[model samples]
Target: MKNNTHHKTIRSFVTIFVIFSSLLLFSAQQTHATPIDPQYIFVRKDGSSCNPSDCSQFWSFNNPDKINQAAIDDVLNKIGTRGNNNNTRKIGIGVLIHYNRHNLNNILASIDKLLPLATENQIPLFIVLDGFQYLNKAPELWNWWDQDQPGYDLKNRSNVEWTCSNGSSCATKTAWRNWASEISLAFPHPNLASPTFIQANKNKLNTMLPKISSWYQSLPQDKKWLLGGISLGLEVNIGGNYYHYSNGINPNAPNPGPGNSQSDQLGYAAIQFLGLEGGITSANLDKVVQNYYTELNKYAYQLGIPRQKIFDHVNSPGFTLPNHIITTPESSLSPYGNPAWSFYNGDAANPQQFDTLHTIFQQQGYIEWGAAEWRAPNTTYSSWYQAFQNNFNFGNTRFINISNWERIRSEPEILKAIKTIANEEPTCWVTKPQINITTDKKSVSFKINPGNNNQKTRLHISSSSEYRENGLLQNIDIVNVPLNPNSTYSKPNLSDGQYYWNIVTTGCTNQRRITAGTFKIASQSLPGDLNGDGSVNIFDYNILVAGFGTKYDIFDYNNLITNYGQ
Candidate 1:
């Protein structure tokens, strides 16, 4: 009896030992795994001395003296080095240049000086080459809005319009192509000797319009690398009060059909210019109107404008992709193909819009896009930080540009804001969360190992891949689960389709706490699977046929073509 009891006790000890060893192994794997990719944030410094109040008039092009060296030095002195002053290590500096002035010499000279500083600091520079402006008030383009020019119209039409006085005469397409071609030629290999190119185009040079290509061609190779990426135009969308002007004036205004009050020459011009007729049906009128921008995108590519080079800028809201645009040269896909966002706004009213933007870009297979230009909302450091934080704290955005270095040099708060973003440490995860979907596709189970004993696991679930809605985070469902080494949380009644799960440990003492578990759901439904039955069958076909020739008709057809009978 004594021997049997001793043997039983030994067995009990072995069982406990096995369980404890398993737990420790699991903990070790959770704590030490591959890290998430680093996030990059940048503070943009404008290379020009343009007026802070108005971006339209009294512009000087590329004055090396006007490059704001003091501001550059100040920003560099503080935040140029990663992890400097205990700030985030991934932040870099960005320099913006509108080198499309009458003489590219000024911007070129400015860039030459700035590039070495950027190189010495190991930073990336962003270059913006302005495209055609319709009624550009610059003194050089005397014929821009002139009434007697070939494209001009009277009846206050010419006075009230943007871009071309009439639809047919706008040089936007030519100007876009020219800017790209000019920049590529101007920045040819070996050296930045653009004087000869300038001399060759001297007869044709528009003294008022910028010499962007000439300026680029003039820069040395070392100087060119500072221009990591070139964004064409400040804001590429058609400008003016076209949306508000229903009374025959704004060139970019919507056409309210043939007999509406705002319907007239300008409306007809827009309709014709956008190619909206074939897709137009009574029910799909709104869709056709929305597709007008898509048509603008199509027309832009048709003009041989390099989507690869142009980071399409959106100064206002409502210019984002409605669905997706399938364009050519695969390299020119959305986000990258039609990359756009706002420079003036602090945050999107709809957080889901950011997710949708990421989804659209990802669908086109782009790994990253850029945050639009950043400017301090108010004079305070807190306000600037909030503005910059709200805008840059989105997914898959790799680059950011500030309005001017002058602000960095002069505003103590702006530099502080830059430091704050630069020093931000990503939340670390003990282990990647494991996500499981039940067979019925109605429930999702998430399991994450807690990072710290004091930390609570924060869980967020979303139908969206990016956990956002209408460009905001209003739609994401957040729940805090108790800290457990292997905690399981199951959410039932989830609709069929793709879902995303993000798990991060909270309440940690470390300021550099990282977020570990980010995962997507297991299933993907076909695009044409309208009934959510997991397959595109006869039912989906019927739905597509019924909705044919309507707003989403094109998308349906695309779905059918891609996933027919699947």
Candidate 2:
């Protein structure tokens, strides 16, 4: 999405900046006016790899106790109850789809169990197609390197399976295309296709895209959007691409060979193998990447998916895309040294590097990016969450692996922060609303143009001069009001003093609120009403007579003269 396109004018951008600033100053974890849509938190047991070095399946498949409907409900209930108070649903599971059939079937079964509950709570599910139905470790694909294939120069051909349709290298693109054709719409998986069969049929990607989209369209309308989208390949950077040759970087050559300067390397080489002449030069790498995207875009279009819907998964520390969603999987802060933390370390004081990279992506016209598998360095899960909140903008989508659900459950602060961020409804770029205020001495009122007439609206009045999310300030009163631009709320029984107030309007999936507006209630007393009665007459005269001879009587005499007739 274009920056200038989303914010039509400078004023709109300034307004958002101001609102964001106010939120920073006053709201620590207050109820937000807006809630996030498709709020996802990864569930372990179902998503975590079974092994450390390489995970081919989820633990849930082998151990049912690890993930169940009850566990899923617990997460949604805990994290989806803030902004919109959608406890029944809203929290989504983030799981991985691998080349294994049983693992795929097991996940689908979990989704089936989850569907009913999800429907009630508006939850959407996420899937990471780990390696697209091709297991690089399977013996046929792994140990059996095709010595006959002319240009197969890379070590362990099975280690890198994403290559073009050349007879020699068995890792062909057709495997993905065929798997795409085999999966069902509701919860897609190839029809009992064994890993070996998929590995052997790795040459049919051309037929896959269209079939995948057709299945998508065939699903029930309610279920259609549940498949949020798939990240093309899991963390496309380091799957095995870090291999370096003698002069550095080149794993494949025109003929089969052994070590040192292998011809075609991993990712960058795959593109050239698909039919590009120039090779992977620093000058041509970017172009190669773009052309690679262009090719993927064609398949995505065939699948009836939009460019924005296809998230680009990056495993590198620094990745900038001119216009695409860059999703980081297993991302962490630098000191964690997990090797997943990209360009910026999790340093609070020196965040400029990450900011700089983010700026570059934005300048290239990208609107948003996020971490798919994120955790902080050496902190409790809750602190890890807080670190993420402190470091990144919550305006973009975020996710946490559910395998840590136990930690989240144990840490109240982390759970609270997660819910706060998750419940903030996301506004589409075009429909975001702004607030304006009007005030008088006794009352404060606000208006949201393009008002949410059908949804609930809240007006909060506080004696404090600024807004506070915690509502710890004295004399804070909140009231439910009609969601109309013309509607005004009056402060009741205000003790003739200044007051500050704000209004928040909530819609089905979006919300907007205004900053505090100041107003004062004037003291109500007539000049001659000395006795405090409504009128001035004998009551005032008698007081004057009682004190006629003293200094107090002098003041009484002044009052008597001033209101003698009244």
Candidate 3:
């Protein structure tokens, strides 16, 4: 009986030991694990590829009853909301409301139908309030302004030509500023309009913004979060390459200049609109464009929308503006100091655009930014995969809206890329560590604080044999050294060079690699420079004498005596 009891106790101890060992192994694996694939909130614009006739019927502005529910559902289903792949990933639905005076009721009715579906499916609604889409569809909106300027129809054209009653040449600087200001203000707050301005003529047409804000406010508290964000305008820009004439322009159009193309017409119109006597330039154009978005974002903020939720779409590659320039597409349209939405359709293999964007973000200390629209240059699977991978590797890309849902859905490669992104775990920096020393005289000691407790953390140290190539650290030397938070890790024998360190924390769902920044070790230590103050002097001798017995030995004193001064 005694032998049997002893055997039972030994078995229990062995089992407990095995379980404890397994738990330790699991914890270690989680701490050092490579982050999973990135996941994104994939959004598709509704009725984007429909024919004009189909769109008119499907998105009926005059008659809400005529709006086809079945067609809308079919599109939504295919986007993976209520389809066969309902469990695939979170899909957002975008609704574009072409603002006009007579369509408020119709717009509301359409939203009423779509909002419930989005809410039911737990999908986000990307509401795009497009002011330009109605330019050709509702010519009457521009009739009051068109009366003074005949032959210059602001219809189906990307550029807006605002001429005075005295002709295109009569616009003064003050007049241009006033006109631009009034238009910019009126775009957001249509009711508060200057009676003298041309924008006032379409006051009723621009009321859609406030009306939509009210509609959004009136929703149940639970459903309000479903409204992803409201875009003030789509791809808002000052007449750049994007602002080409919808119907090809005649190269021989007179008055603006001789041998003028559509681009020249845009430049001329921009000059008149901005009152820039020096013609089209990035600085002048950026100011006007910035103000437009600033006012729009301001009004949206007043309506209780958070800064992060409001977006203005622009296609400009993110560039750091000069000091004199207060705003650009990158700065002004940024929801909160980071461009929330920009289009990317460049070659995936050579993603130099993102490189520039990454540098700007790093320099400005902005946390999150996203590609509002991204598409592969080609239909090949490799092209799509490379494009998605490039964006993913940059690490801050929070959103990527496929430009054309119909086209993307048809291509197996594009769909595969989307699926791959959806399945991947999103890697993000949680809290960057604050290092003790930025530059060391000789050896390096890193006192790292990851700034979070109760989380599994590890330290990653890397040295680049060659200095950074294209803003990326090369040749990683050390990685995944287990570390306790807020602890000191000293490399007392490191040679003179720049070294990078980061903290990797394993969270509940995602693994965060927090960059602790780079430190440089300059070998300026003399044999007797115990104080490490560049030159071996009385200070070095004092340090050596102070720690004679407890810290320093006879060798240290000998070194100090040998190279005391010269």
Candidate with the greatest TM-score versus the true structure: 3
In model 3, the clashing pairs are 36-425, 37-424, 37-425, 38-424
Whole-model Cα lDDT of every candidate shown, in order: 0.41, 0.40, 0.47
Error of 2 at 43 (Å): 5.2
Candidate 1 local lDDT, residue 405: 54
User: lDDT value for candidate 1?
Assistant: 0.41
What is the alpha-carbon RMSD of candidate 1 to the true structure? Answer: 20.0
The residue ranges of model 3 lying beyond 4 angstroms of the native Cα positions read 1-40, 46-89, 137-225, 241-249, 252-262, 265-279, 318-344, 347-355, 429-566
Worst 10 residues of 2 by lDDT: 332-341
Number of the top lDDT candidate: 3
Report the Cα lDDT for candidate 3.
0.47
**lDDT leaderboard ranking:** 3, 1, 2
lDDT of 1 by residue, 336-377 (tens): 234545444434322234454545544533333555565435
Q: What lDDT tens digits, residue by residue, belong to model 3 across residues 1-566?
A: 99998677557545644654575566445434332112245545544245554353244445556544554464454443321132222345555666543456666676666655555665566676655423433443333333454333433121333322232342211111111121111111111111222243235324555555665666554344456566665555544323222222323333221111222223344445446556545665555555455555555655555444555566546423232122244433332222545554453333446555556555534334555555557677777666777765564444556665544544667666555555554344243343454233556555555532216666667884221211222445754467655676666666666676654444423323333345565555678776454566554555655686789865665576578674
